[model samples]
Target: MKPTIIRPQGLPDSVSSPVVTPIMPSVVYASDTPDALDAQYEGRTSGYTYAREGHPNADVLARRIDALEGATGGIVTGSGMAAVTAALLGLCKAGDHVLGGDQLYGRSLRMMRDDLPRLGIETTLADPTDAASMEAALRETTRLVLIEVVSNPTLRLADLDGIAALCKARDILLVVDNTFTTPRAIKPFEQGADVVLHSVTKLLAGHSDVTLGWVAAKDPDLQRQLYDFIVTTGLTPSPFDCWLAERGLVSFDLRFDRAQRTAETLGRWLAGQAGVTRVLYPTRDDHPDRARAQALLRGTGGNMLSFEIEGGRAAANAFAAAAEGVAFAPTLGDVGTTLSHPASSSHRGLTPEARAAIGISEGFFRVSVGLEDPEALQDTFGAGLAAARGAR
Candidate 1:
């Protein structure tokens, strides 16, 4: 998700504390003296020499996110996957074992399963919701443990406290993907995560207009390690994207509150709908991990939820066609409501049997709730349910 380098406007001599964050797009900064340049390079002074190395916009966003996540320090990356890769590369060496939740985001699971192995880092997938299972999967060489605060598509909650405690006792770094449950709902650092990762492309950006991510480390040394990896690999995000993401953060709390409220309303409505067989929402009493959700999350279930339409792919497609205002977009965390079919989108890479084993049935549709009026949105979903029934 490399962005096109947009030439920035001419630099001003200085702006006296502009209300808005100014996007500094210069790829390189000039130093007044060789001593100063060496000082910056040696980390004896704070400065930006290259965009790939550091930039004011990224530094601002990183600081903001670090505060939000209660992290000791942080770094921004070009994308979510890049953040994951950077964290793993910084922390693990060849022969080190990385244990990740089986239900992590598809690409993340792929990186651990298929990609990291190539680098001589071994990865094991375990049930993140079950602390005992995670303990059983750990090996003497295990160096990192990864889990999503909430499983993708299914809305399953992970036992973060338990998992974090397990990792702490064993001296393994615990990485939690806070993409689904953004800091608005829960901060992984408070729950004992060594590193917190986000797809700023999602909720943190809110508008679905940016491709960026960040890694927040609980330790300063760990943050430097991740930062060095990002800079060395040229994985820093463009200044423009970082600026947009910062702007998005301005309304993140408000947008997330509204969307999550509507998600609760929609979840209740869908549970009683004609064609919906089951609904997966953290706030729902019947959710598989309700107890954990109650203990770990704020009162709200996140803005994301999934439901099983009566028919498989056919009903799902028919529902999408009839869900008037809702776009059948594969992505999530937009300001507008959109539907994603995991069978055909997020989890499509998995074999049919593999998906089924994880409860991602052909009929499942994950919804990224938005700021739409709840009643009207329910009406829209009602119409889609009728169409789904007809298709069945």
Candidate 2:
């Protein structure tokens, strides 16, 4: 029997619509016209005359992400940092000020602290968990308020609705990094965020094979502005990378669901174990923002969890070295569980004082759970804990 090719309706068999499939080279120039060629040759218009500006695959991924986030539209970028930089630069000008959350991604912290200020854009970091503190930090020149739906190493959940309301009242754009809580788990736009960003390298892609980023916004104008900046600045994702991301999205729901369940089980098990000083999972009872997290996040608390060891840096390093089955790596949101020592890896650029300010202690370890059996994962940690404690 000849193979039957099943293509998504309204999309060519070569390309996935809702999710992009690989396209054949033969189809690349199928739609090119003499007029289009002339326009490209003449550098005529702002429309997609080249893939650098826009491509069908990237556009589809953007639309799918926008639908998932319940936003007007979205733009895909080459990397998470590109998405963040594009969003921040597109929204604010030289004289503008940005009010950002305290527990941001380390690279984002660097951008805000080092780069933006050099360009005359000032920033103030606030603890979004403390609404009073966030309010107090806002200034008259503030043009944007940025927060992560869930922070990188700490797993701290920001008050999205509260921050959105604050930004709305102050006429500032509310930019949220929704990397930890992918659209499968939470939609920040639905919760009142003006713009939602994602490190598609993480949960959104799920496979850890691609590096892509996205920004979803409620206002069409805002979306257009961001898209324009991204294209003009040449920070857009390649067609191939966009296709990989789209394929990843097809399995995002199932992957995240399984990972979240494993995370919850591990979080509870770790909380009960000896030599574990603290477990910071959003669903845990002792979490400071548990109530707010429950109120805002729709599905599971997510796969990322952070814990501090009883014996500080030495113990943490020992546990990380002794851990079996899971990979002790810097990046997160992969099919295989990976661990990060933020004080040294992600947040290394920050001063010791800055790291301490965000509760990222020397003993802390951030775990990104994967789709592995809960019992196997638990036993691995149990052995690692024993080894770590013995070393002390």
lDDT string for model 2 (1-392, tens) is: 98865642244465435332554222223225788777764668433456666777887788878778887668889999899998899888998999888878888988888899999999999887777789999899999988988887887778777788888888888898988888877878777788889889997888889999988678888888897888789996877778888888888889988999999999999999988888999888899888888887864689999998877778887888888778988998898899889988998877888788888788889999999999999999998899889877
**What TM-score does each of the candidates earn?**
0.95, 0.89
In candidate 2, stretches whose alpha carbon ends up further than 4 angstroms from where it belongs are 1-20, 24-48
Candidate 2: give the clashing pairs: 16-21
lDDT of each: 0.89, 0.83
Clashing residue pairs in candidate 1 are none
lDDT of 2: 0.83
Judge candidate 2 at residue 280 and give its lDDT. 97
